[model samples]
Target chain A: MSTVVDQPVARAARRRPGALSLGLSRGALELKQFARTRPYLIFTLLFPVLIVLIFGAAFHGDAGGGVSWTQYFVTGMIASGLLATGFQNLAIQIPIERSRGVLKRLVGTPMPRSAYFIGKIVMVLVVSAISTAILLAMAVAFYGLALPDTATKWFTFAWVSLLGVTACTLLGIAYSSLARTGRAAPSMTTPVALVLQFISGVFFVYTGLPGWMQQIAAFFPLKWIAQGLRSVFLPEEFAAREVAHSWELGRVALVLAAWCVAGLILCLLTFRWTDKD
Target chain B: MKTLIRIFRRERAIVDAVTENLAISVRGLRKAYGRTVAVDGLDLAIPRGEVFALLGPNGAGKTTTVEILEGFRRADGGEVRVLGTDPRNATPAWRSRVGIVLQSTGEFEELTVAEVVHHFARYYAGADDPDKVIDRVGLTEKRDARAEKLSGGQKRRLDVALGIIGRPELLFLDEPTTGFDPEARREFWGLIRDLAAAGTTILLTTHYLDEAEALADRVGVIARGRMVALATPAELGDRRNAMATVSWQGPNGPESERTNAPTAVVAALAERFGGEVPGLTVTRPTLEDVYLAMIDKNAISKEEAA
Candidate 1:
């Protein structure tokens, strides 16, 4: 008996996998699970496409400068796609996972909490990229929107995505703690995402909104993300219609970066492995 | 006298070994939620390689005490050492040594059983072979099936597979056989026995007296947040020495007698019949009988205190 008891203790002295590697492995598993859930995958990817088609058709013609309403709405929907994947999806999913005891089970293992977050972030990044690509394809094929033609414009698109997706994903994780149960998560998360989309210039034109609405939208990451993507999809001359009278690219980076930090802190403070008292 | 002293010295040496190599130790453990006391002044010590069952009625602080030991909840007051480290301060190395099968958990509905097992195996420093673990739990047939497709029994088998995959020295099983069918329960018991035979220190909290009697080396009965009794199944409540019931057919009708001397009573009944006694039978208190009586007494005492 003593010999058997000593066996596991000796095994425990063996090397553990690095957290980063484990996190990446978890990310792959997360992606596989996400892909296998057919309805969730289709709905997540199709939403932005439907938005681009419906709004692009309803609101036609030019909206100042050389950019048409269809082109402008396409960019806005692309930004919303990122939000839908990173923010809306996770805010609802995390609570469901929490209520289901998935988080609790994971916490029971030797895996680090940071690895769990990393895996989630990785999954969101992959899903958001797929969603963005679908929206981009719809923009070019249906709306005749041209792809970004210059190196600088593509650079702008890349950075905006990295910062915006990261910020929204972290904030989604943070907000999930507020949802009490899996049944309540969608109601709690959907409204916030929709309300942000409306106020953040995804639904309506930013310059066309009332000044107070613009001021209110300025405090959130979604507004800056949409604003940043608009600079990429629309022509350079379209920047004149922005609230700042220019793209204000630097401020977009700063605000999104700041929100990323804030989201991380909130996540750290409120995150719980189990919902039980 | 000298021989008796030698036996006493041998027992003392065994006690010293137990003290020096305790797997789990708790003293004056207390926990309260708001104004409600969940666990109150509970003390427990389980020696290494012992399969111990904790039996209690609902709301008896069984789950609270187990969760605190598993480091899922904080104790309001107590000293606890699991694997020689405070559970609150347990490190990844410490977690690696402990496995927990909660009463219920959300399964990865989309992931195949094999995939989920492989994923969790990455978290442990000394995980067993994933294929072998699946085979051991009798899930090899369902290895390719999604978790959502598993029945209740299959899901529990998956849970057990995951619990032991990490090669943990200590395993915590909380009401593991709650929903199992009779045959499934028997099979699960066999698995538990095998793990115990391999020297896993198991802390099992169950409502089943027969399960405790079947697997545990010792059983502790808890009531109102305290350890009411602790002993081997046969000796619990002094059951082995308890009065037995003898019954037989009489000319008047059926008759029975309760006495400590059941064999003598049975012999007298046989002699009176001048042969085999009609409907002759002897009965001793079962583990369930003793367990229920203990719980009933505790309830009566609690009502009196209130």
Candidate 2:
């Protein structure tokens, strides 16, 4: 009776997919799934827009100076968006997916285990870019901030934003791996984010803060991201470049990359796919 | 008997030649949780296109063993060939070939059944049609509905649908009918039977003896990490040749004898009656009886050990 059917089915059952493909597929799938959720959509797009508006009011009557509030606000807004998307979003999604058995489900599938993390990276990048565009629009139209003309300023913006995104993304991933539940991630991430915002000179320039506080900020990844953003949006002469002699671009990039490396290692070590544990 | 044994061994030779004949094979599998041994040196060979049931109680290591096969957890030691590959290093191609139905289900609250299925299908080179899979699981009306809104049974059906939509070769049905209503259970059974008939090799683990007795070709009873018995449902408790209770109209009432041969006792009773015996009955140990006796014996030993 069995002779009438397939022998290849069992053979097919035995195969598993490559890690890269699995990771890419999982990333795409996660992004698609994440986009459909109303809360996630609001957090990704709306949260940053709200931040821009709040700061827009605070910087209301003064956005035309050499380091105009609008220009300064745009750089900060982009950095914050990257932080929100890369750190907060990751911390929220990982623990929830782990709790929900989404992570576990992927583990059972032939999709590469790393694909899930890779997918998250892709998702954060996409959301961050979109958020950056929205802030840029606000800076240009509502706040009357001029677009940078010098190729160097644009280069600084790109590198600085990349640095922010990279550091925040890795830190988020590392922190999420520590979180046991999705509910706890927001609480855990909010404090680190808020603390980093204060320390990164996001609210006020780091030069004005106490020396020790600024030094402590220099040690953290967020400080470099915020510093990079300042290098892009702020004029070269307003100060706060004392952390490293000449913007410390190389050291910042290296430190951010190191965090990414460390994050990958931690994720591999502790990140669980299933809610079974 | 020796010749029959030789023939069965002969089937083993062809097994290697016809690589696709054996859907899954396990040898010397062991798993331990901390100091407690869960699945110890287990062995199993399930042929392609057969529904094999691994029946055990809670904490019998059924779930652990299944997780190892699903490649969700790393085994301490074992040789497992699922389809034809070791699950621990399973490739995406290998993954697409296997389907798993987990016991606890959590879902994306926003995704419709159709959307979830469609999304999973992209992982496999060859995937079943999402609509067809949904219809097969009897969730056509609920296809557009959000997964969060599905009833318990319907949610399970969606889980089943996702498992099969990959068009997997070997499907791991881990107590698939748990928490299902009787009607829903029956319907799920029908779906399972259909999947088996369509050439899917199913490795089912269930606590329900009735379900196993009804659906399985062969049942392997696992107790404390050991396969204590492996045979057809009727032969599980030696039910085929086991003693039966014979009762008939007696001096006071219907007395009974537990004997291997029920016919002889019934014949003697017929002679005493000098006609058709009133209130005559012959009954063997039911699957449930055998199961209870089997577990009862273990509980007694556990108490002794304590």
* Best candidate, TM-score: 1
Q: Which digits, one per residue and each the tens of the lDDT, describe model 1 over residues A1-277?
A: 3234544445845577888888899899999999999999889998778877788778878887877888888778888888888899999999999998888788888998789988998899999998889888878988878998999999999999999999999999999999989889999999988988898888888878888988888999889999999888888888878877899999999999999999999998988778876
lDDT of 2 by residue, A165-244 (tens): 87778778778877777777778878888888887767766666898888887777777776676666566664344445
| Cα-based lDDT for every prediction | 0.88, 0.77
TM-score of structure candidate 1:
0.94
Candidate 1 local Cα displacement, residue B27, angstroms: 0.8
Instruction: Count clashing residue pairs per candidate.
Output: 0, 15
DockQ of each: 0.51, 0.35
The TM-score, computed over Cα atoms with residue i paired to residue i, of candidate 2 is 0.83
Classified by CAPRI criteria, candidate 1 counts as: medium
Q: What share of the true interface contacts does candidate 1 keep?
A: 0.63
Indicate the worst ten consecutive residues by lDDT in candidate 2 chain B. B12-21
